[model samples]
Target: MNKHCCNDMTYHANFKCDIHKDLFECPDKLIFFHERDNDYGLIIHDGGSSSIEILFCPWCGKKL
Candidate 1:
């Protein structure tokens, strides 16, 4: 997996919720990383998996 700009970004991108046990299964998953696209996004929990692409790290302001 590609390294994220910050630890917070990394953690969120690979989030494993204690309740859901998996990022994909978590209803509150916030950040997302697309390996194929090599980009990061903010997850939108609107009943389906959707996200808004983010250019900079929300935690560190680093270019992603």
Candidate 2:
């Protein structure tokens, strides 16, 4: 398996930083939300333990 190291932390994928990169065991059980200054908050929810992809950077809370 391939892994990347950042901030002395090793992860299976890109680990830019704590705020930017992370691994969640039950990602599907969590609801991700993004809010902008004027725009309505964007919410993401997986139906189950299925894989999900996000386009925004969770670290900076910016669109990717």
Candidate 3:
């Protein structure tokens, strides 16, 4: 796993199960955090460029 910081940081993940295997298998949701202050932001799965749909977190799996 790798971490990157910028104006903002986003979480990325991928999934592959007996379910939605037709998905991008990439980050369905991203939890952006500012290491500078430990401030966190939530980005709900909206099905867009920065959209998230899966319930898995490659960063920190937490009921997303």
Among all windows of 10 consecutive residues in model 1, the one with the lowest summed lDDT is: 20-29
Q: Look at candidate 3 and give me any clashing residue pairs.
A: 13-26, 13-27, 28-52, 45-52
TM-score of each: 0.77, 0.24, 0.26
Pick by TM-score: 1 or 2, better one: 1
Residue-level lDDT of model 3, residues 6-53, one tens digit each, is 222342221233554433232443554335654444444455434333
| Full ranking by lDDT | 1, 3, 2
lDDT comparison, 2 vs 3, better candidate: 3
Which structure among the candidates has the greatest lDDT? 1
Q: With candidate 3 superimposed using the best TM-score fit, by how many Å does residue 38's alpha carbon deviate from the native? A: 0.6
Candidate 1 deviant stretches above 4 angstroms: 21-25
Best by TM-score: 1
lDDT of 1 by residue, 1-64 (tens): 6578778888888776778754555777898888888888888777676789999998999989
- Native-to-model Cα distance after best TM-score fit, residue 10 in candidate 3, in Å: 12
- Model 1 C-alpha lDDT versus the unseen true structure: 0.81
Residue pairs that clash (backbone atoms under 3 angstroms), model 2: none
